[model samples]
Target: MPGRSRPIDKFAAAVGKCSKESAVYGKCILADYNNVHKDKCAAEFMKLKDCYLAAYKKR
Candidate 1:
């Protein structure tokens, strides 16, 4: 026998699961970037440069 769950309960369960998954992955990636090497992270920071370029282009 099992108990019934509400729709909101199901939705919250799904969101909690995704946040747990994302935190685990984000920590792993950040630790790898901080410990092993920083080149990949450095390149990732270039997205800001692109953002600035796009803003200037739009103006």
Candidate 2:
């Protein structure tokens, strides 16, 4: 039998949102998910991370 497909992670979903909001930041992070690119979108990513963490804490 085929294995189940897991749902997308919060960070990835956040990245998608960032992409929609800012094409440049989106492309940068998507191309390279390392410290350098992450620093470029630190603010946006931080918001997403906080939101994800909050939701997780509630759960």
Candidate 3:
């Protein structure tokens, strides 16, 4: 049987499902962390946002 889990655990699981997108976005930010400008990572951010939305819907 499936064991009960906490809200945070569920959230983490959903996020884990989108780890690739998250890593891409994270890499974009870290690529220029010191002097990052606006929209510098817009494309990556959009992908991450879409992944999160999809993950949220699946939850």
Q: Assess each prediction's global lDDT (C-alpha) against the native.
A: 0.51, 0.55, 0.85
Compose the digit string of candidate 1's lDDT tens values, residues 1-59. 26876656665545454554445545656776647555555444454445444444443
What ranges in model 3 sit over 4 Å off?
A: 1-10
Cα shift from native, residue 38, model 3 (Å): 1.5
Candidate 2 residue lDDT tens string, 1-59: 36643345544554444433465445657766665632687776666566655554443
> Who is ahead in lDDT, 1 or 2?
2
RMSD of each: 13.6, 7.1, 3.0
Model 3, 1-59: lDDT tens digits are 38866778767877888899889998989988998999999999998888877876777
Worst 10 residues of 2 by lDDT: 4-13
Q: What is the full ranking by lDDT, best candidate first?
A: 3, 2, 1
Inter-residue clash pairs, candidate 3: none
Deviation of model 3 at 52, angstroms: 0.7
Better of 2 and 3 by lDDT: 3
Which candidate has the highest lDDT of all? 3
